[model samples]
Target chain A: MAEDVWILGIRMTKFGKHPDRDLVELAAEASMGALADGGVTMKQMQILAWGSIMSGGMGQQLQKQIGQTGIPVYNVANACATGATALRTVIMAIKAGEADFGLAVGVEKVAGAGLLAGGSRGVDGTTWTPRGPVGAVAPLDGRIGTETMPGVFAQIGLEYGHRYGGTSFELFAKISEKNHAHSTLNPLAAYRKRFTLDQIMNDVMIAYPNTRPMCSANADGAAAAVLVSDTRLRTLSLEQQHRAVKVSASVLTSDPWEEACQVLPDVNTLTRNAATQAYEAAGIGPADLDLVELHDCFATAELVHYDNLKLCESGGAVDFFNSGATWRDGRIPVNVSGGLQSKGHPISATGIANVWEICHHLRGEAGDRQIEGARVGLAHVIGLGSACGVHILEKAAA
Target chain B: MAAARIPLVDYLRLADEPYLVASECEECAARYFNHRVACANCGATAFKEAQVPADGVVRAFTIVSFAAPGIEVPFVSAVVDCHGTSVRANLVNVAPDPEHVRTGMAVRLTTFPIGTDSTGTEAIGFGFEPAAD
Candidate 1:
């Protein structure tokens, strides 16, 4: 039988622009924090995996930073889901019985990175390269598609508003305010200040319907998780066992090219598909969840996922918010860690960062922002390919 | 001198009067906008060449105020369902406002120059315009 996995330790650096720190130092800080949290030493980690985007050859360099133990290291990149991908990799290693104690680290330095600062700079910056689609019916079919995440998501907000017929823009503002307010309680959050709905709505518009506050910042940070298999947990010390949080379900799904046909592609068909699978794998539904940490790359994205994850009816998101269903003290409190909206989305680090937040909830250690009796928590992230990874964790069976 | 023209995408070639080219799958009657190695729908490799009608309905659109450094701002980005396939591009020849660009609006495919090379060669790309009656 495949053995169950437990998050023995999870930690992340305070998310913000760490211009003084490079990727290796960021990763080392996170990994060491995780190691200390799990009560494990570098020598004990059987395998190490990293989730990074565009770090060229930082995988081996990071290993050296943590003391080259000659352990097998895997570098993974799946857009924004990179960190969760790393976590999933370690889960697979433990499931395959190839590893006992594993470490999964996700890191990204988006602050000064050319793209992170915004705009497509590089050798290709000024070059007008027209790469036409395969069979554009007309010369101009689908030509203005920009890779700016905000642009695409803003389009989704507009379409969703048109389809549903409501003040989605207002709802978006409320969502931003809620998340920013939550950030005030989260010390690890990148932007810890609260925002009024007017402030969020009036902020400079990056894309129509999406203001600066509505979109997560280009952030820099790293998060790491220590995973120990059930078999190994039996031998671990009492402290390790006490810190262990059970993984009830973990699922990752990529875009089904057909999703392109959807009017709001960013409404995320993949998240729906993955969430259903994750709920099934966890043997629980959205109703049973005590807390959730979804992508929230954009406020509208979060509103869309509320329906995609079956947390509420399709158009009931605004109502869900009004009813206080997703408030930090509501029926199913969400983003109490402030989410990517406030916590900072360091691309690759977001995956494990979500995990770290959920672990805090599951372990009953999330001091001020903690949800009462948050026994079940969900962590979700959607990559640019529209890839989605949903993971469910619960307090280990006593 | 008449500037040389180029297609932004590999599949595109001409800058003038350029219409969309597409591929049809033999296995499942699935049609693609351009030639694809395999059928996205039914997964059959057998394909036939076809061209999509230049018209589609505006499924969704946005006004992009920020983009890559070189890309212009405040353009109307849109997803037009051309020939059963979703094509994402900017809606041109229209104001970047809700009153001007609307969902379910009729749009026609058109191409415009993205930029010109210093060597007098212009790179052209495609977009959608409000369909004329």
Candidate 2:
């Protein structure tokens, strides 16, 4: 039988531009902060799994700044799912009995990176150039159709509206408004000011039905967590054990082959697959979840995910939002930490930061936005190369 | 000088009549754009060249107002469903706005110059335009 894993400590750097801080510095802050929070030292860590999108050999470089621990280290990069992937690496080690104490840190420096490109940069940046031993070729982006993040997600939202009635530009804007409103309570969020419905609706349009405000804020940040096996937790201090959050389920999935998926990533099917497996592993359903922090890379994405995560009935995401169930005070409050939109999506850091939010609510340390009695919560993140990760966490039993 | 023209992609045929071709799966007959080694739907290695109809209905679309460094903004990007196969392309010969473009709008394939090389060779790209029934 596999041993259980518990998050002993978790820490996240404020999500915003840190022009003075380098990637290693941000990573070190998160790593040391997590160690202190867990009441453990770096020397006690048996393994390290570091995730970053913009850098490599981060685990080794991170060790130099923190400590020269000779433990096995894994460097992970999976687009936006990098952080969750790194955390999962540590959990697997603990479950496999490889290590009792493990540390996972995710960091990225993408502030001012501008729009995320879907394909490679072509020579002219306008037409498709076939790859081969031939002349200078351009990218497939502008020629065929834009594979840009904003365009892809905007199409996804419009498709949902076409498939199911009741979704409109105003509805999508309303979703962004809610997230902006939620940001006011999250001190770590990049943009704390709330926007009215008109502000979100009238914001600079990046893509139709998705304005600039609806898009995820690209920022620099890092988040880290320390995990300990259940047995190790028992030997820890009484306070540490009391504050631990149980990792009931950890799952990661990729896009299954579908005709449509080959063209435009089917963010829906993979997310559903992960969610189903996570719920089955956790022995809980969406109904039982008290809070959720999902990847709202775009406002349009959040609506579709509400259905993909099974938080609502099939073709019922708009209705679910209309019911006010996703608000902080509602039945199943979501993105109480302002989500990726306001909390700022630092790519690799976002995955673990989402888990950090759930852990906060479960530990009752979420301050003003706390979801009272958040015994069970779920955190989700999906990247465009088509990776989806779902983790279910629970408050330690009294 | 009349600029020499060339299709932007190999899948587009510029001979005689301009139209798009796809690789059809032998097992499931699912059509896909460009070259494919196997079927995404059935996983069959065998494929046959199939010509896709020029006409399709806009299943989904977006008017992009922001883009990367060099690409122009406020263009109509759309997913057009020809029969059952979906094609990703842009809507052309029409204004990039909600009033001019919409889902379920009838359109057909058309080609336009993406750029011209120093040799005066024009690179042509495909897009969908409002179809005349």
Candidate 3:
């Protein structure tokens, strides 16, 4: 018999600073919340998959708080893909019959703890040129100019402008303006303060067209999920099954490592490939998406992704934003929960946050940030180097 | 006269007009800005050295405001399309303002000193400046 997987419970801490708190506290808080929501206890957790950038051995550390369980635990980390990758492991293990119940939890404290606590590798580890703009400091292999993350994306924005005429700087500002405004409605967001287009444009420049307001703020938070096999789910009551959202599709992919340069917003090849498979698996297309919670770590990224995800034609983003099609009441609302820009990005927690937000929308539980009658949702996250994780979610069939 | 110095890359020359070192895939005829161990286009390992023109059109550019330690902020970094190969370099001799630096502008490669070592060997690196008429 083919195994079907379902998300039984989802929980996320308010994404903000908790400097005095450590990873164990953050992880357990979300983990316990998920268990409570799903009507499960630590005794039922058969497998564990933990996610983070640094502060390793999360599954073990978290076990101490929840009671030491002699179960198989996996520590998974793939940059920004940490959350999705961790959640996917849980699904895979449950599908393979290794376990009937699994937990996926992720936590980080980058915003409050500083950069070293965040995941910045110092010097000598670049796979690209003597220098690439992915680092904020000069790496061991390259000069200082090629280090900041903003620099890499800035280069991409520039190329987009050159290739198909231009990627309007105003367009990227509007993305920031919209996302910040959306965040005002989400109390869980780290930054709920809104900014106008003029304010966003006038903010300090991080890299070229990307202003300080255009980048995602580092944050501290945790998000978790509880997954169970359909066999186990069938044993639950009708009310439990009503809240279970189906994990329709999940895909993880990496770069081809070919000898060539990458364009920032033009980084569509890998994502485009992921989209084709995920949509096919979900039995849906871009037009079918009721809501999306994706990696908008940067405002510019949101613009490029709308095209990469094939939601619109290439070079159509300039008009896409102006049409308000992505607004909360628009046809396909994006980041209605404020996204990374307003919600705060804790790296490891981001993917799980997206999953959490989408699940809430699917269940009609999202309060102020709800997308009206959303039926299907997509959660996407990308890690530089890079790894891409995309998942599609829908209501489970009765 | 200043002492002669070598470029950061073996193929990059700093003695005269600045230039770039490139490689071409024998199988696919695709070119690259720096040397390649294998052809990313066709997966062929055999590659021969290729020369790139000093001047090319700017495909994209950014003025880096917050940068690594010791780097001057508000410096213009550019991705230049040198013939068919793409080169990542900083833009020099031009104002770092959007009004001045823009995509599709003409640029030419130039070499600059990157400080000397204990052995008195200066490190030479390459950048692009607005092209001459």
Candidate 4:
């Protein structure tokens, strides 16, 4: 049987613009902080998995800055799922018995970076490049259908409303209001101010039914984690073992064919598949999750994900939100870290950052936003390249 | 002599009976707007050119009010279900507002001027407009 893996330590830099700091600086802070937290050194780590979207050889560059241990490195980039993908790579290495201790880190510096071009790797600059059919010099986004993230997600939310009645413009805005309200408690969030419903509603509309506040705040940040095999974890001090959180389930899934999924990336089915697999692996259901930190890239995404994650009955997302179950004090509090709305989304960093949030609560380290007596938690991220990752964690026993 | 006109996309036919072309997977009949090296659904390498019906229903839509620099906003972007195949396009010939457009609205393919070049040639793009029910 494969050995179980536990998160020995996790650290996330404050999620906001660090204009002066580049990717390496941000990554070094997170990596060194995680190493210190784990009470380990770079020489002790057997492998390193680094995740980032910016182009460059990050792992080797980081190794030079931190230490030249000559450890094997796996540089990963899976859109927004890069962080989770990197962490999962380390977990797989540990399970394969390649080495007992490993480190995973994700970082990105996207502050002031404008709209995302739907998941396509096409060139987007002042110069027109001929790539797609027809040799079009520019992106077909505003000209044809919108391949922009805001437009894509806006259509998705509206489509969900059209299929499942009872969803309206206000409901989606209310979800954003909830996330913005929660952001006040998270000091590391990029935008911590709470917005009134009117403020969120009347804010400059990016897409119909989705305003500026409803969209995620793009920022620069990094998150890192240290993983240890169960055998190694047992040999550690009692204090370290007690603080370690068990990796109950780690799953990643891509889009499955449905009629219209090609046109609209199937965020729903992929997430459902990941959540189902995670539940089976963890041997627990959504009800068992004390808190959750899901990818709320947009407020519209949060509501649909509530249903996709099976947090509520089929087509019960609106009611679930209405019941206030996703609030900090609700039945199953979700995104108490203000989510991507205010907490900021640094792309690659978001995945490990989410796991970092859950580990804090699991270790009783989450300060004001902590869910009291929190035990089991889940972190979910869906990159529109159509990849979804779900990680479930369990608190260590005293 | 008339000015030359070009279809903005390769799949759009500018012939008398203008219609969109899709690469249909021979195995699962999956259709793709762009050229596909292989079938995403069945991994089949075989495909055939399939003409898409001009008429479609609005399955979903959004009126984008904000956009990247140099791109106009407040346009109606929609996913139209055309004879089982989904096509992404902008909705035209109607008010770009919720009160004017809605899901299930019938629409038909139309063409509009994208821009004109120094050679007096015009580039045309495709869109969907409200069809008389």
The number of the candidate with the highest DockQ is 4
lDDT of 2 at A82: 93
| Better candidate number, 1 or 2, judged by lDDT | 2
Ranking by TM-score: 4, 2, 3, 1
Ranking by lDDT: 4, 2, 1, 3
Candidate 4 per-residue C-alpha lDDT over A210-305 given as tens digits, one digit per residue, 9 for 90 to 100: 899999999999999999999999999898899999999999898887878878777899999999999999999999999999989988889899
Please give, for residues B1-133, the per-residue lDDT of candidate 1 as tens digits: 6767766654444634577655667777675555567776667899876666678988777677766655667888887877576666778999887678888899998887766665666776777899898
Which 10-residue window of candidate 3 chain A scores lowest in summed lDDT? A133-142
Local error of candidate 4 at residue A236 (angstroms):
0.4
Ranking by DockQ: 4, 2, 1, 3
Off by over 4 Å in 3: A112-145, A257-259, A262-266, B9-11, B23-43
Q: Quick one: how many clashes does candidate 2 have?
A: 1
Higher-ranked by DockQ: 1 or 3: 1
Candidate 1 at B26: error in angstroms? Answer: 2.6
For A1-398, candidate 1 gives per-residue lDDT tens digits of 68889999889999989989999899999999999999997899988998889684476787788868888898988988888889999999999999999999999888644334334333343444543344222233124465567777777766666667664568788888888999999998888999888898888877777888888867899999999999999898887787799988888898775634433455467888999999988899999999999888888777777878889887766678778888898898878888877888899999999989999988889998888887899999988766788899998755
- Pairs of residues clashing in candidate 3: A123-A140, A124-A140, A130-A142, A132-A146, A135-A147, A135-A148, A136-A147
Residue A86's lDDT within candidate 3 is 95
The per-candidate TM-score of the B chain, in the order shown, comes to 0.81, 0.91, 0.88, 0.96
In angstroms, the error of model 3 at A248 is 0.8
lDDT of 3 by residue, A126-198 (tens): 2222343221212221232354666676676666657665477787888888889989988889999999999
What fraction of the reference structure's interface contacts does model 2 contain?
0.45
> Which candidate number would show the highest lDDT if scored against the true structure?
4
